[model samples]
Target: MLPAVPDRAVDELGRTEGGPETLGLLVRDQHTRRLLLLRAVLDAAESAGPGVCPAAALARLREDWALLEEAERLEPSAHRRGRPYRDGPVSGRPDGSVPVSEGPRGSVPVSEGPRGSVPVSEGGAVPGNRPPPSPVRALLLHPLTGPWARDTLRALRSGTGPLTGRDTREPARALAHFGSLAAVAAARAGVSYAVRLTAHDGVLTLPSLGALRTGGPGSGETEVAVVHRRGRLTLRRPGEADVVVRLQSGAGAWSEAAAWTSAYTLPGLVLDSAAVPLDDLDPYRTARGGPRPDTLSGPAVLDEADRKHWLHTWSGTAAALGLGGERRLAEAVTLLRCLVPLAAPPGSVPGGAGGSCSGTRREAFGAVLSSAPATATVFAATLVHEIQHTKLAALSEMMTLHHAGPEARHFAPWRPDPRPYDNLLQGAYSHLALADFFQRSALAATLPTLRDAAWAEHARYQAQVGAVLPALVGSGDLTVRGRKFVDRMVEVYERLAEQPPPRGHAARATAYVQAARALWTRRHAPGE
Candidate 1:
């Protein structure tokens, strides 16, 4: 049997009890799920056809899988767990990949603060003149979340006759990525092998590693040459430049290799991460205004100005976190891996004096789709709020918190319409965090103006949590564990509530909730 989260840990997470340690366990669980999905993808391809997904391509995947398995056997801990959430979106793009760090368990460490320009924290370099760390997980994940994998899985169940050439090519093309990833592994282990990869739109992508310009129609073989021998990689193709990547000795950030390719590695505040590129290089990357999960605004690609703006905001956010407490910023960095920027909503400023925290996001195990922040506080608040979604999604996947049922009738204080039981739970948990954030901000705010704003926001969210809690418990959706989870959450809520509301803030918040509920009832109540 696969590893199970200890019952105690689950309950602790339910109540928002455990800190980063608990969150780490949840992140680890996500890594396991990604692995299972990888196996599923490979199996699906294996059973399909030598035609749909080329025989040669499938064979290379098998070869790499063998090597990865051997690596795991040699160092079982290397595959134990990977970086947390940053897979694909939750709804349309579920079952995406998480980058598993290759090395002994806990061998990789997050970089400390920002580096010179890139904030990446690659752990110890490989000793002596060895190759780079394995690119196994990243190799699998990037393509798996892209349209190709989605279509491949869809076609398998389409029940439509044999897949058309159009359908077959994407998976075939996806299979080609293994060549690039395998090359990295071969370089790391000093193995000898060759794997030819085809390109899409003239780009040969190696997920999490890098890409090469393989100029040809999406159909032809773009590979110039792929030869791996005796610790040297010779990927020279025609007149094109060779695949020249500088491998770091110790376990390096996967984003670092991406620097060699078209991928844009984001220079984070204290953490290092990469933007999900839209260069044809990343088959999964969505173009501007591309279709996305309904909960998301279309993800925006960064231009030069946007990239600079992103980094500057991050610097401000880091400063904001410094005031909130180390734990606050620390937790945000740990939960977030990728930021999918969305166009800012009209009528709202991106950066007011304080941050807006108004980014449209979903609980994708991978990204937090956001707009630019209005203030550092808004950026900080967005992190605090989104991390709740991250935790709850992982928790739900790890174990059932609620029974299977159609449960969209609960009153969520934040929404005008009645939300599903799941939505209600997520909203309440996040409100709990929002209340906590404002409380911390109110205390930390030096300027009188800022302190008052923080206190008011704190009151409002605290009241929202209070109003929603009873509705959540009364929904009859929670299972035994779910009940325990909510009950524990209530304990935290009550403790937080004990801190007296600011001035008449309590009455104002309650009245505001009541008025909103009354309006909702007029519009949505039974028989309306």
Candidate 2:
């Protein structure tokens, strides 16, 4: 027989005497706001005097800001009528009952800050009591809510196919364990918890008598709710097609059950729990026990700090690019920031480029050509073009698990062609392609000054490529095939330039695709 449920619930039947539980969140929000302002100030200071300012001072400010923001953001919003409200827009809306973070008791941790903490909904009245008309099918859990709820929520949304995918299953299993603990706690507190498993068509709904809701795509919205009670655990739903849960203080009424439903359906209850090793559950693990391709690593696996850095760099670069609208610039910078780490490594750096690589490249290295006006535009386009080349190369490397070896130079195998010479030609063409593509699809999306920048670069690249390529290929020993390859590469790009701008990404992407394939096909031709 199980013990009585513990009465350590966040909510107590204290009647009207209890003051509001949400006042703490306001304090947390204040800290968060202050931190944001500090970050902005630090960014301005660093940008103002990149060389003059001490690196330590800048880093200190940034760290403090992040720490404070996390503490504030991670804290649970005071629950109002069972729903949790996070401090920022990033948090799901006010009526969202999704648990932000699991509490220490396997319940939702009431997050007060952005730190590694839990966030509770704003209101509370126990969610399972209000069941939606239709059978619950799915549940979305917020990361800020209960650990088990958040974990399970992550699992389902990730779709490694439920019991698979490390990101999905690991969280699910953690959630399960947390649910078990919560159940034990609830049992002690005289509250019942139960688990109900239902399957309709291919969809599997795991319901508990707790609050749960799915978040918007990528928003990490709260999706599931968890509750623990004495006797039987129950999982129910709030609406149709969405899964919810409810828990009551009773046991053993498994009658008239639907084939889709089996056993306990209460939050924090696991009737017959089984231990599944986290590694085995994740399908991303290979037969050899190695991680699969999509496994998180490096820049592909960006943390919050990386995300922030990306945003900062992108905003700075876009502004430098002379993008007029700050809002558009900010968004573009954010996207670009996401893409930067994924960008190709431009040749082996002599050593690691410091944290502010892109910034230093812009301000110190000075890629922008001021005199020729168009020179800056061409440089920007070329950089983007080369960046794409790197992206393509990286993708290929990941697919093959091998990097491409340098092709033997036709004239002198011992002395390879310089990167600059190659990059100059490649970048020129790429600039044309990217500039043209952006102009067509995202015209309004980009600031007008960008077009002027691109045009300037186009002219500069054309002049440089025409002058340099001839000298590089002039060596008498250069092979016909090699010469043809180079000539065709240049010629095709010239033709591509003359052709009208591509209609959309499909057309633009296709242009590169076809050209590359054509080049490859030409290489294997019989006449060679």
lDDT of 1 by residue, 1-528 (tens): 344667777666666544544656665665555445544566676677665556665565565555444332323233345312112111111222222333212122212221111221122111122122244444333322433444445544332355444444556555555445545544444444554555556666654445665564555666546554543345666675566544333222122233245345544446333323222234444432236544434445567787677766676886676565555555555555555566655455456432233332232354555776655677777877777777787788877888746656767667877787788888888788778777777888899988888888889998889888887777576788888888888887887777766777778888989998888889888899
Off by over 4 Å in 1: 50-57, 63-134, 137-168, 178-180, 184-194, 209-262, 266-281, 285-291, 322-326, 345-349, 352-366, 504-508
Q: Give the Cα lDDT of each candidate.
A: 0.56, 0.28
lDDT of residue 346 for candidate 2:
35
Backbone atom clashes (below 3 Å) for every candidate: 17, 106
Residue-level lDDT tens digits of model 2 in 1-528 = 111211221111100001123222322332233333323333343353323334533343333223223223322231123322222212222442222222211122222432211222223111222221111000111111122332333343444233343542233233233333223223323332233222222222222322122322344322233232323333344453432232332211232323222212111101111111111111111111333222112112234554454344333343343332222222121112112133213342422321111210111010111111122233233334433333222222222211223443222111123233333333333443354333432333355455444343333333333334454455343344334434544553455356333244335444444454355445643474
Report the Cα lDDT for residue 487, model 2: 52
